[model samples]
Target chain A: MVYTSERHSHRGSRGRGSRGRRRRHPEPPRERTGGDIARGIVRGFGELLFTAGLLMLFFAAYEVYGKQFETDREQDQLAQGLEDQWEQQEVRGPDSEPLPGSANSRLYIPDLDLQWVVVNGVSQEDIRYSPGHYGDDAVSGGDATAAGQPGNYAVAGHRTPGIFWDLDLLENGDQIVVEDAENFYTYEVIEERTVTPDQVEVVDPDPFNAENNEDPQRSLLTLTTCAPRLNNTHRLIIHAELTDTRPKDEGMPENIADMAPETQAAAGE
Target chain B: MYGLIWRVLPGPWPVKLLLTLVLVAAVAAGLWFYVFPAIDPYMPFNDGAVEVEGG
Candidate 1:
C-alpha cells in the first residue's frame, strides 16, 4: 500500500508540474486571465507604433532632400548647354511649354560678357534664389510681349529678403535671359522704372497698346520686384532689350561655374 | 460597455499586432497618394534667378 501510494503521488506531482508550465505559457488554453492578454496586446501595439513612427520620419526626410541631389547633377548639364550655344544663332521662346522642372531651360547673355539662365518660370520652391512668378512674387496683369511684338516681357520677384533683393544693385545696360528647351534669348537693360502696384501696364508685352505694332516686336525683357529695399508699396522695374539669341551648337563658353545650394551654404558659413 | 467590449475581443497580442500594422499602413497609403504629391513637402525652394553666361 505504501509503495503504491508513493508511486501514485510521484505521478500526480509530474502531472501538476506539467500543468503549472502550461498555466505560465497559456497557449490556446481553455481559460485565460484578463491581465495576461492585456499585456500581450500592449506590447504588440507599442512595438508597431515605434516602427511606424520611424518609417514616417524616414519618408519625410527623403521627400525633402531628394530633389536637391537632382539639381546638383543637372547644374553641370545646364552649364554645358549654355556653352554649346551657337554664336550667330538667336534663340526664341519655345513653340511648346517646357516640361515641369527646376533646372534652367535655356541660357542667355545680353552683355556677351555675362551669362544668366532663365528658370522656366519664376518659382520660390525649387531654387531659393529664383525670380519667382507664383504666389506673392507674381506681379499680376503685367504686359507680356504681344503675339507679334516683342517690346515687353515683364516679370516680377521678391526683394526684401529673398532672391530679387539684389535688384536694387542692377544697373542700366544689365542683361537678362529667358531660356527654353531649345534656345535662349538675351535682353539688355534699357532703364529702371519704379511704379505703384496699380501700374500694371508697365509689364505688358505691348506697353504701346497699339494693334500689331512692330515696335513691340523689339526683343525686350523686364524684371519686377518690390521697390525701395524692405518696402512693398512700389514696384521696381528693370526694362531691357533683346540683344541676341543663341542657338545650341555654337556651344557656351567656359569660365562660368554652376551656382548650387552648397554655394549658398558656403556663403552662410 | 468597456468590459463587455474587452471580453469580446481576446487574442490580445495577435490583435494588437494586426491593428498596429493596419494603422501604420493606412497612414503610409494616405501620405503616398495625397499628402506627398500635393504638398511637395520634400522640395526646397530658396533660389533666386541667377544670371547664366552664354555665347
Candidate 2:
C-alpha cells in the first residue's frame, strides 16, 4: 500500500515514462494557475513565519546564556582593576566624590556565594556589567551616601544570570558584606520587599518614609533589581543595616568566612 | 527551503557542503553580534533599576 501511494504521488507530478526523457532537456515554463499562485503565497508565508520563530528562539538563548559570558568577563576586569587600586592604597576618601562608572567597592553575598565589584554610579551604562552605587544625584531631593556611611548605600543591578538572578533567595538576617579599600562593612538583611518602578523612595535614607527628612542614625544598604526573574514590571528591594565593620588587614569577617571553607582556610582561622 | 538551496548550488556535493557551513556561520555571527545587541536595550531583562519620573 505504501509503495502504491508513493507511485500515485510520483505519477500525479510526472509519469515514470517521461521522467527519464525530461532529464535531458528542460521543460518549457508552464503558466501558473490561480490555485498554484495561492499555494505559493501560503508556502512563502509559512516559511517566513518559521524563520521568524527560529530567530526569536536564538535571541532568547543569547539573552539567557550568551550574555552571561560577557558579564563574567566584564566583572573579572572590574575586579582586577579594583584590586589594583586597593593595592596602591588609592582608595577614595569618604568626603571625595567617586568617578562615575568606576569600580569603588567589592560586594559579597556569602549566602549566595556571589561577589561583584560595585561601580560608582547607578546609570544604565554604569550598571550594565556590574552593580552600581546610587550617587547623590540618583534621586531628586534625596541623598545617597557612600558605603558604611550613616545613610542609605543604594545599589542596583540587572536581573540577568550571574548578577542578581538569585536575589529573591535572600531573606531577612542574611549577611551582605561590602568591602572598601580600608574596611569590610557587614550588613544584616532587615527586609526584603517588592515595589513598583516609581517607588524611588525605597532608596531614600529611610525607606518608605519620605516625610522623615532627618539624617539616618544607622548605615543601611539597599539592593534593587527586577522582580520575578525575567520580568521587570516591579523592583525587588533588599534592605539591610550595617552590623559590623572591620579593617581589611584583619581578614574576612566571621560571617563571610564561615560561609566559604576556602576563605576560612585562607584567613588562617 | 534548504533543500532548494542545496539543489541550486553550482558546485559539487563537497563544495556545496562547505558553502552551506560558511553560510550558517555567517548568519550565526550576524545574529550574535549585531542583531542581538541592537535589540537588547528594548528587552525587559536588564531594566532592573527603579527610576522616578523627572528624577
Candidate 3:
C-alpha cells in the first residue's frame, strides 16, 4: 500500500514507473473441477424450473382472465348484430322462425342475477358467443314463435362466468324468463337434475314422457350446461314450466324489477 | 443475476442500455408468441368437450 510521489501516475502516461502505482488485487483462481461444473449445471436447471413455474402462473392468469376479454368482445359483436337485425327486420310473430345462429332472444334468471342474449344454435361455436337454442326435435326450432310454444324450448350455455355459471345454483320454483323482442315467456323451475353427458332425453318434449305431444299442453323451458366446473363429467339440467307471457309493449315483467338496470334496459321496458 | 449480466457487458453506457432494451424486447416477444400460446390448452378453464347433443 505504498503511495507513489509521481504526479504522472494518475495521468494516461503509461511508463514502467507508473505501472505498479494503481495495480488491482490479484484474484486467486485455478480451482476448476468436474463437481463445480456439475453444481453450476444443476443451479442453472433449478433456475430454469423456477422460470417455467412462473410462466405457468402467467399462462393460468391469461387463460382465466384473457379468455374473458375474448368472450366479452364476441358477445358485444353478437349483441350489436342482433340489435341490427331487430331494427332492420319486421316484428316477428307466433309463426316466424329466426335463422340458425341468429340472435333470437334473451334469458333472465332473477335468482342468479344473470342475463344473456340467447343465440339460435347449440354448436360449440354458437354457444361460444352466447347461450344457444337446442335445435333438436325434442325442443322447438329457433323461431320467435318458440317463445310461448306448447313444447320444450330448450337452451344450452357454457358454465363460465358470463354465461350460465350460476345455473347449478337455481332451486326449484325459481323463475327463468325467456324473451324475444316482442314477448316475455316466464318459466318456473319445477325440477333440477344432473345427468350423464349422453342424456339427450332430458331435452325431450316430455322429459318424463308423462304425456305425448298430441295435447302439447305445457310450455316448457329446459336450460342445460356442463356440470362441475373445470371438468365435463355430467350435465346440469333445469326444467321450468311456462308461467306467463307478456308483450314488450307492456314493459318488462314484474319479476324483472329487481334485476340490474342494464338487464331491465335490455328487456326494452 | 441481472447485476451479473450488467457487470459483464462491455460497452459505453448508451450502448449497454440499448442492448438491455433489445434483450427485454426479444424475451417479451418470445413469451407473447410462443410460450403463452403453447401452454393455453393445458389450462383448466374453458376445456369443455366439443360434441353435439345426440352423441
Candidate 4:
C-alpha cells in the first residue's frame, strides 16, 4: 500500500509540473489599475509628440540650410548660362528691353559680401533660383529694371541665406553695385524701413503716393526681404538711388575693383 | 508598438534584424514622401509674398 500511494503522489506532482510549464488555456489579460492605464496613455501620447517634434526640427533645419544647397547649385548654373549668353556673337544693346523671368543682371553688395544674378519677375517660379525683379506689369503694381530706362529697379529675395539675408546690416550710404551686359549702375542706400507684408506701396516707384504713376524723376533701387530674420510678417526695404552709371566696356568700377578677382573667378574666368 | 512588432515576428536574430531594417526603411520613406509634405503648408518654410491693399 505504501509503494502504490508513493507512485500515485509522484504521478500527480508530474502532472502539476507539466501544467505549470506549459499552460493549456491562454491567460486572461491582467486587470490593469486605473493609474497604470492613465500612465500608459500619457506615455503613448508623449512618444507621439516626441516623434513629431523631432520631425519638425529636422524639417526646419532642412529649410534653413539644405535649401541653400539647391539654390547655390542653381546660381552656378544660371551664372554659367548668363556668361555663355554674353559670350555669343549676338550682343544686346544698352536700350534692349529686359525680359521677365530671364537672368538680366548681377547685383553686388560689397559691404555684405553678397552677390546674386538677378532674374526678372517676382513670381514664385522666377524667384525660386534667384532674386526676382518686380516687373512693371506685375499684378502687385511695382516695377524693376537693370539696364533699361531710369526707374525703380526693385528686387525681392528670401531673408534666410544666399540672398538678401544681411540686408539689415547695410546702413545708409552703402554702395550697391549692379551690372548688366553693357553697363554698371552703382546705387547708394538712402533709406531703410520696415513695412507690413501687405504694404505693396513700398515697392511703388512713387512710394509716397500710389496714384502718382508719372515718369520716375530719378533712378531708384529697392531691395525687399522678409524682416526680423525668420518672420515673414513684415518686409524690410532698402531704398537706394543711382549714384553713378558707366559703360561696362569702361572696365570694372573703382568701388568694385577689389572684388574683380573674386567676381572673375565666380564668373568662371 | 515596436516592442509588440518584435514579439510578433517569428525568426532567428539575423532574419529578424534584416526585416527590421527593411521595415525601418519603409517607414522613413513613407514619412519623407507623404507625411512631411502634408505638414509643410502649416509650417513657415516658404518666403512667399503677402498681399497688401493700398493704405
| Candidate 3: residue A159 Cα off by (Å) | 1.4
Better of 1 and 2 by lDDT: 2
Please report the candidate that would top TM-score against the real structure. 2
Candidate 2 wrongly placed segments (more than 4 Å): A1-30, A84-93, A140-142, A208-212, A258-269, B1-4, B52-55
Better structure of 1 and 3 per lDDT: 3
Q: In model 4, what are the clashing residue pairs, if there are any?
A: A198-B52
Question: What ordering of candidates by TM-score runs from best to worst?
Answer: 2, 4, 3, 1
The DockQ of predicted model 4 stands at: 0.24
TM-score for candidate 3, please give it: 0.71
Ranking by DockQ: 2, 4, 3, 1
Per-residue lDDT of A170 in model 1: 65
lDDT of 2 by residue, A1-269 (tens): 99767655554465334344455234432434344577688887898899899999999899988888888878877866776655544555455666788887888999999888888887777887788888878854546677898878888888988888899999999999998878899999999999889888888887756565366777889999888788888999999999999997898788777654543332232
* Per-prediction TM-score to the true structure, in the order listed: 0.41, 0.81, 0.71, 0.73
DockQ of each: 0.06, 0.46, 0.19, 0.24
- A155-246, model 1: which lDDT tens digit per residue? 44545332355666667776566654344466667788787766755555444464533445565566776666645567777777776666
Backbone collision count in every prediction? 45, 0, 0, 1
In candidate 3 the C-alpha lDDT for residue A25 amounts to 15
The 10-residue segment of model 1 chain A with minimum total lDDT is A132-141
lDDT of residue A23 for candidate 3: 53
Kindly list the per-residue Cα lDDT of model 1 for residues B1-55, writing each as its tens digit. Answer: 2233345655786895676667668977786656655555233332222121010
TM-score of the first chain in candidate 1 relative to the native first chain: 0.46
For each of the candidates, what fraction of the native contacts does it recover?
0.03, 0.50, 0.10, 0.15
Residue A66, model 2, lDDT? 80
User: What docking tier does model 3 reach?
Assistant: incorrect
